[model samples]
Target chain A: MTSEFELIRNHFVRPTPQAILGPGDDCALIAPALGMQLAITTDMLIAGTHFLPDTDPCQLGWKTLAVNLSDLAAMGARPRWALLAGSLPEVSEPWIAAFTDGLFACASYYGVDIIGGDTTRGPLAFCLTAIGEVPIGMALRRDQALLDDDLWVSGQPGLAALGLAHLQGRTVLAEPLLKPCLAALQRPLARVELGLELRRRGLAHAAIDVSDGLLADLGHILQGSAVAAELFVAQLPPLPTTADPVLARQCQLAGGDDYELVFSAAPEKRAEITALADHLALPLWRCGLVVGAAPGQLTLLDDQGRVVPINEKGYDHFG
Target chain B: MTSEFELIRNHFVRPTPQAILGPGDDCALIAPALGMQLAITTDMLIAGTHFLPDTDPCQLGWKTLAVNLSDLAAMGARPRWALLAGSLPEVSEPWIAAFTDGLFACASYYGVDIIGGDTTRGPLAFCLTAIGEVPIGMALRRDQALLDDDLWVSGQPGLAALGLAHLQGRTVLAEPLLKPCLAALQRPLARVELGLELRRRGLAHAAIDVSDGLLADLGHILQGSAVAAELFVAQLPPLPTTADPVLARQCQLAGGDDYELVFSAAPEKRAEITALADHLALPLWRCGLVVGAAPGQLTLLDDQGRVVPINEKGYDHFG
Candidate 1:
């Protein structure tokens, strides 16, 4: 049997040139760059709750780190370091190797160093804490949205949920949509560049990742900013012609698992943001606008400007 | 049914004056003090592995954070913030309230801020990431042991193991020893001040927390420093009179769960360390010396000036 130390050395240990001290020590030491603040976030993924027990180790690893990186991206922080603490029912060298491969692949892409973590025996679960750096007092905050700001979302927000629905046999996706949907579900990319550019160029006033569907996550920004929103259903990214419009609407409105960014910016910056979309070759959909109304209140509008009642409010881990 | 947000607002939310942004945001933002290096560590506690399933919620919460704090203590860092990512079998309000109570108590005592984390529904488990600050280049590293340094350990090393033995019916403890042993096992305090003073004053050449047994943890320092050790068994803290001497010896030699600090210091600093012990009113046991030998080699010496045969090295989580 491989000892814990052997397991760490073989699988988890990697060259962390960015760290003052990496794994094997009681703690990993790092120095945040001068005049920078650290943005820290943690996410716990439990087998069966976050993914199927037999989910592919590689994709699981990618998604796990991606979700936390998305959090940093939402804050306009450059990804820096991560610590992954996990529990496994038993040790399987091949599983661990594949998992580390995927995890390191993501870390490498984001220029993040896996500094330190702990692993123990138990039900399969992983908790990752990611740390990123942003210039002092310059992180895009959720509470800074100005009234009448143009609210935008990146990428298609409902595809991952559609992929999940297909997986659960609730929706049948067309062949062309299957791969992209599943990719969105299993390997969503963190919007690090988009977020950094938005912050550095002063394009966004407030931002949040669209993890819990567009409406629900947008609700966070509205609530935090003590404002309201007017979302035009017609302006949301179009549902695929082959897909069920109602289900896609539901997914677009309240789907979970989308790692897209939903941000609010001054209306005048819309042209600049559109140019940014072309520059990054990514879609930037303007689907809503911040409004002055009761805090936490949201109104969905149809193309004709009629109120559309909403029932689904996004994913709740407990609900 | 209570939503995850309600649970977070009701139980996990706490004032974080130190954080630029706290819970409810995608990430917590903190600025490490200028001219300071950040020491970060992560620990995962799994049910039935790290603690019994029926363990008291309050104590489990305290021990979970304490163990990670112990790691910070080992690095001679001043713990400043923590992120707790946990999975729960279900949402039980009372249990969460009690757990947070204990968690906050420890954080308050140590001057740490509970910044942010994630919680989800799943099997019961927790992962905590602790971040601390140390003066640049002044952290007590495990690789800095100099030849001929006197090795020291703080407080009792074997009581926690004996406490486990008592709980497991492997041994019976006398009335007087029961409370302290159990306390050592369940509520072991992190020696933050001792570690801080040792590093700030440059009194210790190397340090590591005695979590995976004194010998095993000490071996980390030995291996990292490319040095060896000669531990005087007779000079170790005395075994309890009422306990079986042989069993006590085994526990003292290779006990796990002891959150004590074992350090190595130059022979010249012995007087200052002794004075520190007196000042802190904590027993600092001098038990060994660093030796010039093949790296990672360790020798156990009996009072009769003979080498003692050894079998148990320390606890292996995977073994």
Candidate 2:
């Protein structure tokens, strides 16, 4: 059996080219880029809570780190380094090997270095702390939204939720949709490039990642910026014809686990944003507009501009 | 009933004066001090493995962060911020309240900001990621021990192990030793100040914190620096006369959970180090000397210069 130290050395230790000192040290040493500020986020995943206990180790590893990178991406920061700490029930070298392969695969794709972390014996769980760099004073923030800014959401937001529903047998997704939906849920593609471009080109006034439902996450932005929003139900991306439209709309409005970026930009930048969408070959949906009504109030409007009633909010772990 | 967001905002959210942006955002923003490198470390504490599931919530909170800070102390870094991600079996308001109090107490005492984190539902566990700063090229390292340097240890090394032994009913502690031993086990003080002083004054060649037993942890330094050590058993801190000398000696030699720092310093710095002990008002014992021998070797010598044979190594989570 591999000892704890041997397990770490054999699996978790990797070349951290960007770190001044890496995994072997008591603490990894990283020099912040000149004139740049560090953005830090931490997320925890627990077995049975975050995923099924028997979920594939590889996908679990990818999703664990991907969720954290999504937060950094929302801040328009370049993902740089991460520290992973977790508790394992037992030592299974094959499971660990597969998990690390997926973890390193995500880290490699995102240009992040796995620097340092800790492992312990207990129920299965993982916590990841991701660090990224953004030019001083340029990172996007939820409180920076301006009244009348065009609210944009990158890519489809409900696919992950639908994928989860399919897995739970709540919905049977069409054969073609099943693959993409599961991919969205299991292997999220964080919008790092879009965030960077938006910040660099001065396109976004504020931003947030859509982890919770679109409405609930947008409520976070509205509450932070002290504004309201008028969302057009007609403008939301259409559900696939084969999927139940009501359930799909419910998932789009209030389902969680979508790692898409929801941002607000000046109305004048719509053309620039459209060009960016074409440039990145990703959809940028103009779904709403920031308004100046009661803070954190979301008004769903139809094509005829009539108010629509909706009840679903979002996921709260302790709710 | 308080939701997860409310629980966080009400308890975990503390003022982060040093942070550009504190909690409530997607990511917390911190500007690294100029000319300083960031030292980052992550540690996970599982209820059953690291502590009793029914242990005091307040102390558990303190130990979670303290262990991570101990890593920063080992690096001779000034702790700046921490991100705490954890899973709870259930939301017990009073338990969380007391836990946050202890957590914030340590963070406040250490001048660290609780920036951002995540909370999920699962078996109770915590992961703390601590970020500290050290002057460029000035952090203490394990691989810098010099031959003939004095090996010094801070504080009593085996009290925690004795405390564990007492708690497990393996040993009956005398009245006077009980409280102190329990405190040593439950509330360890990281030698942050001593580490800073050592690095700032260039007093130490290499350093590591004693989490594992003295011999086991010292072995890490030896292996890293490619040097050996000769420890005088008689010079080891004497066990109390009231306690079983054999068990006490065993605990002292091969016990774990001691957060005290063990360092190697040049022989010429003895006087300065003694002065430092006076300044800090802490015990600094000169226990041994780094030697030229087979790397990672530890030789124990008695008062009569005879070698002593010992079988106790250190605690390994998976061993």
Candidate 3:
């Protein structure tokens, strides 16, 4: 049997150029950029609950780090370092190799380094802690949104949910949309660059990543900022040309796993944000406006300006 | 049904004065003390592997943080912040309350703060990431042991293992030693102050914490420093006055879970270390010396100055 140490050395240990001291030491030593604060977040993914049993190890690896990176993006921080702790039922060299390859692929893409971690024998699970950096007091926060600020979302919000529905055999994607939807579901890209730019340009007043569906996560921003929101459903980003309008609307409104940035900004910055969208070649959909302080209330309007009553808000893990 | 967010808000959320931003955000923001390097380490504890199913949630919480703090202690770092990611079988509010209480108890004792974490539903497991700080270039390391340096260990090295033995019904401890031994096993304190002092005073050439048995952990230093070590069995710290010499010797030599600091220093610094020990009111046991560069070879000697053969070196997770 290969020891845990050997397994880590074989698969996870890589040269960390940014770290003062990397693996094999008691701790990995890192120096935050001068005049910056470290942004830290942790996330855990478990087998069965978070992913299917037969999910590819490579995708699992990418999604694990990607989700944590999404959190950093939401905070408008630049990715820097990560620590991964994993539990596997047994040691499989090929699986580990592929998983680590996927993990490093995402890390390299975002310019982050895996500094230290631990591996053990148990049910399949992974917990990752990602560290990033941002200038002091410049982090995008949930409580900083001003009343009447325009609400915007990056990319399509419900594609990943549609993809998940397709995977679960509840809905069949059209041939043209199948590949893109599944890709969205399996390999969501975190909006790190856009987040950094938003902060640097002083555009976004508040921001959050769409992990628990738009309505559910938007509720977080509203409650934190002690405000309400009026969303123009007709102006929301279009779903992937689905035939079923009800299903499309459902996924668009309440689907999770989008990893898109939902942010608020002063209405006057519309032209600048539009220019940013053009430069990045990504859509910046203006979907709503922050109403006055009225914690936890969100109103949705139809194309004809009629109120739309929502029966289900979003995905709730324990509900 | 209690949602994951509700659970976190109810149990894990708290005011973190040391952090610029704590929970309720995408990421916690922290500032490292000026002119210091951040020391980071991650550790995972899984059910049926690191602990018994019936273990107390409170003790589990302490042990979880304690182990990670031990790693920081080994590097001579002062712990500052921690992130916890936990997967529980189900939501049990009482269990969570007790666990968080114990976790905060240890955190407050050490002057550390819980900045952020994640909670999910799955088989029981925990992964904690601890971040600390140390003056640049002052961290004690396993690879810097000088040849002919004295090998020293703090506290009783095998009491935790003895407590484990007692828990397993392999041995019965007398009334007087029962509580202390059990505490040693379940709530081992990280030698934070001692480690910081050791590095600040420049008294130790190399350092490691005894998580694995003495012989096994000592092997890490020997291999890392490319040096050999000779340990005198007679000079080893006395076990809790046990009658079973064989079990006592085995526990002292190869038993793990000590969480005590094992360090190397120059013979010329002996007087200073002794005085430091006196000031701290803790025993500093001198057990061996670093011979010359010869990777991975450790010799054990009896009181008669003759070599003693050993069958087991230390705990191997896969062994």
Candidate 2 lDDT over residue span A1-319, tens digit each:
3466566545998899999998877899998889999999999999888888988899888988999999999999999999998788888888998899999999999999999888878998999999999999999999999999989999988999998899999999987988889998888888999999999999998999999889888989998899999999889888767788888888899988889999999999999999999999999999999889788888999999999996888888877
**How much is B319 displaced in model 2, in angstroms?**
0.7
lDDT of 1: 0.90
What digit string (tens of lDDT, one per residue) describes model 2 on residues B234-287? Answer: 787878777778888888888888888999999999999999999999889999
TM-score of chain A of each: 0.98, 0.98, 0.97
lDDT of each: 0.90, 0.89, 0.88
Clashing residue pairs in candidate 3 are none
The DockQ figures for the candidates are 0.81, 0.81, 0.73
lDDT digits (tens) for residues A142-201 of candidate 1: 888989999999998999999999999998998898988999999889999999999999
User: Per-prediction fnat values?
Assistant: 0.90, 0.91, 0.80
Place model 3 in a CAPRI quality band: medium
Give TM-scores for every candidate, taking all chains together and pairing residue i with residue i: 0.98, 0.98, 0.97
Docking band of candidate 1: high
Q: Candidate 2 clashing pairs?
A: none
Q: What shift in Å separates residue A174 of candidate 1 from its native position after superposition?
A: 2.8
In order, the interface RMSDs are 1.3, 1.3, 1.5
C-alpha-based local distance difference test score of model 2:
0.89
